[model samples]
Target: MNRRIVLSGTGLVSAYGSGVAPYWDGLCSGRGALGPARRFADAPGYRGEPVGEVPEFDPRGEPRKSAYARAALAEAQRSARLPVLPPGALVILVGQAPAPEGGGQLDGEEWELFGPSAELRPDGAAVLHLSHACASAAFAVALARTALAAGAAPLVAVVGASVLNRYEYASMDVVRAVARTAARPFDVDRDGISLGEGGGAVILETADRARERGLRADLTVAGAACRVGGKLPAASDPGAVTDCLRTALAEAGADRLDHVHAHATGTAQGDTAELAAVTAIAAELDTPEVPVTSHKGAIGHLLHISAVPALAAAALSLRTRIVPPTPGLTTPEPADRVHHPRAETPYPGLRVAAVNSFGFGGNNATVVLRRD
Candidate 1:
């Protein structure tokens, strides 16, 4: 049986600022936030490239990842405005673990931070940490949907965070994954992704549960599905992504999808593969071409936690019925089936939208959201 889950509220901290408002405004305004990595310029083996760093975030307090998680959680709880939840509610953190040598543990610290947000004892609460690479947040949402459907928890909070630091930057640079210039997704001359720091949180509950409390949802989690590529290491298979999207849309009972929030991060293979998958979906459905938008061009890739802000922007788009542009996309690749909006575009009165997130090791997740 399919259960209906609803999105109650959302919170975020991004390179644009510390709130969802700024993040959404930046997306709608089509302004890129990437700049020089001043702190890393003088460091050993510095690549002297641009990256997105969350302003005022200090890297010394490694465990302070909880700070970002907690701030977003508190704001989400406040925005939810629902009745007090049961003591056994669940909290899920979707993020990358600081290297063991970095002397940081994100799961425990995030739980400690999110625990206070609930009105009940922390001991009985269920806390789960998910590390599925870039698809982490999408997987987190899928888990939350399952928990709510099973009645295992009346409320669930999913938080994701990934901060850029010298260690990780150097690692990506060594592999030529870091762009030497700017972060430009889907551009002909795009080199690679610009690492960005920050995170986002979302509050969710079953639709029936929300109605029981006289609350209305901002968006509904129509459905979510994920798949793993059977290909070689650290690469995604377009076939896997296509299968994932088909299952996700079927799960959502959607025949007409209005927008696609792609996971394009300026990598040649990643962007091309994702666009191919999307184009296939369109051709199979025989629907009009889909307008796609990727936040990475403007916000930079947040690694394990990119889906957080992606979902936040998706929710805003669903409510507003507008698709934000791909900041640096000038030429449409793989034909016009995948529409890249260079400016804010209005939807054709459709309510369903899809958000795709792909991770290393061939992990791909697609979520279908509906507004109504």
Candidate 2:
């Protein structure tokens, strides 16, 4: 029998604070955490837009990214009431490997910190790092589903982290991709992406195991699909994203989705391309227009493991039956099939919600989540 993969717990570290409550509260309040960049030493030299740096992060000695990952994982483990594994669980670290300057092989150290199970550490537990730009977190969920279905492990722990430092901020400046004003998804006057730093984690388990432990699953990983763009790191191909979404929805047996968590960075080309793909799918299926949202407008773009926080928010939406507003999404264009919500809209009977994540290397990943 095929086991259903479900999300059991969540952890988050963002500009708002270190736990899931702060992150979700910030979203529901419709107040963005974006402001002047203070985490970097070379902030004054940055000619780009304001950034949403995590507050009080003083990376004096440790790698900034590792600190973010550790906090998120700790909270996730605690929330899930994770017990010591008996040499059968898997740990997937969803983040880019450390840069050469930072250090070498820190993934293992991070995993050790997150998963303290000696039995699993010796042989059962292994760390896999994905560097698929922004889609890394979404890919982690897809991998967890595959592992659970194959019975490779009874539980899969996915933790993701990403940060914006001086080096990366300068890189975005060179390409003129940094937003001059604010991160506005699907808005007519939107300019570019406002880079941000944050990360989150989620614990996945089989439905049978969750029931055995008397845990209520917030959302199930129904289906997922991934695709890559061709020869362009800065551009998104609508056709590829469309194909990926189509495959994921079809696999999930969802002809219509209630909500869509779009990976819209607020860039002109990026937002337009993604919405076009979603529009095509909606038209092909003849489904009602789906309410779409992008958290980047509120938290800025959390590069690399951006999808982790998005997945957490999607799960929360499923649990609470409310979809938070995509702050700064005022005056959405009328041409797109996906409608940008203006407030914290209550979605009754939200069975399925689709999430899209696109990476710089043309990686497009779609995850379909269902409640009930």
Candidate 3:
């Protein structure tokens, strides 16, 4: 179905802070989170600079032991502030793998070894795990929306989060090898992305339900599309990205994009290919100046959790009409998409914007968010 109604409210914790306010503030200002790399001190061959570290989260003292997923859920519930919400909403949790999965497998370890390390909540509700590479969060969002649309559930709590893992360095190295200086999407010097840890919680419900409950939201999830094309076979990059964008736009009733919050990971191949897709899509529009920016410099790529912060940032841009700057970008050109956020939004009434996320191998997902 093209219409899966958007309800309301969201909660997020990322490299910036444990709340949405701080994260939004940093997301909109073109902030840079690149700092000394300290997560993988014992590992070698991980000589990368600057990482986006989420503010300290000590769950051992005072409060209690809080897993990343649990903390995310709590913050989400607190932020949603939704009253009288459906109690049977399905909980879709992404990144449920063990801590060791990310740290590179030890000798003789199997798939189960790479799964989540946290103990399951004794009272955990019906939870579905999404293990999609970078597109995990968006995948959850799609499934949740579909569940709501199909009347299978009244609401769905979409949570995407990950703890600090040793493989972060391994992943960062893959990104760093491609990108060193900064996360400059479309830039000539574009390399790869920086790894960052993040947690996001979103409550998706029906419009009828939201109104009945008096829930308020800043935007609506007009529609979303996903394309798959693992790199193993022929690896069709352009084909996959274009199909996803086209389908998502068609479903959103949006042919023209006002602003595009890209999955600009700074990797030469990824950025260049994404730019190709962007330019192609933009070419079909009258306003091709949908200023784009990749927030990797501000907060390293949080694989499963990347889209939340980026999508949140896009909502702010559409609200304020300012496209944020690409932190490490000095020169903005054809190949460069990094830009600055104007003090006051130029177009205060911008409506629809696009957020792109493509994962390893070739998982492409594009979401269209319209101001409510």
Candidate 4:
């Protein structure tokens, strides 16, 4: 039906704090939030690695992931002026498989979905769970748009959360993916990811419905594309990323992008591959100087829910016409084609922005957003 979908509201709870204001401010301030990880301090094999942890979070007898989801969802609905979810509204819960209890590898049956869907979904509401590693949230956004276009629901609320837990932290530690200090995306001396925990939510609806409800619709979900490269879990393929970005741009009918929210996780392989992909796409589109930024440097890698914060940053950039600086980025690796800004910059021609999210097992997704 070619229905037009728009982002009506967005909520974020990150290492900086809850609410969009704090998150945006922290990003724009150009300071890394990586600090000592207290969550796993006393656990065996703990090595005092740094992490971007949410402060003062108390789950209060509920799963930390569920608590984060509920907080973010509440803010999103309130921002949309939706006191109650409309009947038949679809809720997409995006995240990774819960950390195994008491250590040891989890079996297939232990991979059941977890989130706040049980508490948030209203009567007649349908719930869907997506666990595509780091790209889960971006994939969820794309699915929500599709459902709305197909008239399967009047609206969709996509909520995602990834809290640092013992088993998951140990897994990354075992692989040496968790940075000893901080994540420095695009930097030549970059090491590994500073894992973070938080939640994010976005409300999407048709432009017609937003207008009918007298809600502002300034950002449009212009395009989305997801792909899988047959690669190892920890490796990234530049070719796959380039293909995904090209398809997303094609779907958006955009020839040039003003800004690119990158998925650089500070790993040597991941950052290099993403840069190669962006360089190729920039050359193909003749936007060689497209500004590229990554939130991982500021908030650390949020893992499965990382895309939500990046998407929220893209939406805010589109609205403000300013690109936030990449925190922890100093002495960026030489890039001949694209500009990686270390300071906040204004993009007078800002209109279209792309958010990239790459996950374990070569899952890649790109979402193109347009300012209306």
Candidate 5:
């Protein structure tokens, strides 16, 4: 049986603030939240790059990642009206672990930071932790769809969180991937990525299960694809990304797309490569004027959990029939093939959207969401 997977609820915590309202508002406002680094401003390797730190977040006591994850999960549960995780529920935690020398991985000694503890997981619930760099959340969603199709669980909750720590900051600085100011995806003068910290969660269940629970099941996970392009950590293959997008659309049986949430992280190579793939996909779909946007310009790159916000944005676009604008895009690079909106655009026929997330090591993932 081909089980239909649907997105029942979504929760997000970004630099704008907690909840979907604030995040959506921030995106539509066409303004970025990136500012001076508050946590690592005085770090040894810090070069005064702006960051998208969560407002009023205190990293003094408990792990900031854990707190963000829990808050996002709580919001997701509330949105789904799931007071407690049901028996046999599957929880997928997505995050990247710090280097061994810098500190133990989040799933290792720092397991409590954002592990599937008793608080987040019930007695019969199963847990899966994914640390596949930036595409971790998209991979989790793909896995959740597979598991639901196989009847492994009635529903799946995917939660991901990442914070701007000194170690990661230093690593980014070393790679020169951190932008000097703010992220300007697809802009002619785009520099690099602006790091951001936050958590996001999305609840997925089979269509039958959602109907049983009396939850709205309009937003469906039409398709998903993950592809490994090359060995380089910071570089991506346009061909691989094109194949990934083609496969996702093929799986979704979609010939047209209403919106595209691209993984343009403001890096010259990354943005250009993604634009090439997106352009190819647009040409294939015969929708040369397809609207595309990137959340990184506003929220900064969320690293391992980047896909969550993109997925959230795509889903909300389907529901609201509005395409959110891309922030920090002043002079768009010459791309007449696609429309990059800098202001909120109404798409009355918005029914299908694709969210792309390309991680280090050429880990590229795409999720096609549809509204019935």
Candidate 6:
């Protein structure tokens, strides 16, 4: 029997607000979680303005954590508590290492960026740090599906959390220049991406278990795939991205996609590559009208927590039937204009959606989703 993979629950933490309602409210209000930099004490020479900083929560050390990682876990656990849960569950995936252990100065971008942090703990549950950069969370979701299928764990939690550190802020110029501060999927002025930090995780199980516990069985994780983009290296390359999307579509057994949740970071190269992939896919058929959007325009890049927002966006599409508009896009990019959808929430034409993500080390992952 084929195991049914579904998204049971998700908990997210970001600058928009710490919980789901806050995130939803921000989205509805056309507000993005962007603000001045606080990642480091002294970010010399770097403007380091307006990043997606997860609000610092410290209830007099009651939680014993202060960074993004702890906030993510606590919120996830809290969300799980409200929902029905199966016993003897396991934490199979962690978006990145614990923040406290890796926490350090906002000093020179190098030490901060290349600094050694995020390690493993013996007492911690079987943990895998899925830090393939931006696609980290997507990869974790994929891992959860496999773990359940292989019987490695009955109940698995995939947690993804990220924070805008000093080093990351320094890299923003490159990102901003590419997406033009507007993340239009098929828009022309796409400059690059904005940096933000947050946490989003899922506690998942087989369809049978979810049914028994009366959990929300909203959508099924139909298919997923991973690849090393070392060959592509740049996040803005068409060949590898096209390959990644094709593989994901194939694994999901989907020939036609209703929509695409683009990994468009607004960077020139990234946009070019993603558009190339979409065009390639579209060309295979008579014509494709799949509309594409990116959450980055609103939330900034969630780093390791990237997939969670994609999950949130996808979930919203599946639940409410309304596809939110692409925020901040003044003009749709020529690259992204092919067969793009222009409807808002309750997008009448959505069925199959693909979520694409890419990370350093040439890591790319694509997930195909469907309403269960």
User: Which of candidates 5 and 6 is the stronger one according to lDDT?
Assistant: 5
Which of 2 and 3 is ahead in TM-score? 2
Residue-level lDDT of model 4, residues 167-263, one tens digit each, is 6777788988988778898899998988888889999999888777788776899999988664545437888888888999999999887888999
How many angstroms is residue 171 displaced in model 2 relative to the true structure, after the best TM-score fit?
2.0
TM, every model = 0.89, 0.89, 0.84, 0.93, 0.93, 0.83
- Candidate lDDT scores, in order, read 0.76, 0.76, 0.65, 0.83, 0.83, 0.64
- Check candidate 5 and list the clashing pairs: none
Residue range 1-372, candidate 6, lDDT tens digits: 347877766777777767766776666455566666565436553454445666664524222112344455556656545232345455644443444443455333333233112331113346555567778778878888888887776667776555555545555554444232434444676555677766666666677766665766657888888877555655666778888778877887777776778887667677777877888887774344566777776777877668777777777676666666665555776753354434464566566778888876687888888875
lDDT of 1 by residue, 104-184 (tens): 453643432222222221456677777787898899899999999888887888876665565566667788888888778
Better of 1 and 3 by TM-score: 1
Kindly report the root-mean-square deviation of model 3 from the true structure over all alpha carbons: 4.5
Off by over 4 Å in 1: 39-44, 57-62, 82-85, 98-123, 212-214, 232-235
Q: Is candidate 1 or candidate 2 better by TM-score?
A: 2
Task: Estimate the overall C-alpha local distance difference test score of candidate 3.
Answer: 0.65
Task: By TM-score, rank the candidates, best first.
Answer: 4, 5, 2, 1, 3, 6
Model 6 lDDT, residue 76, Cα: 60
The global Cα lDDT (0 to 1) of model 1 is 0.76
Task: Provide C-alpha RMSD values for all models, in order.
Answer: 4.1, 4.0, 4.5, 3.4, 3.1, 4.1
Q: Write the per-residue lDDT of candidate 5 for residues 114-133, one digit (tens) a residue.
A: 43332455678987778777
Candidate with the larger lDDT of 1 and 5: 5
lDDT of 6 at 137: 76
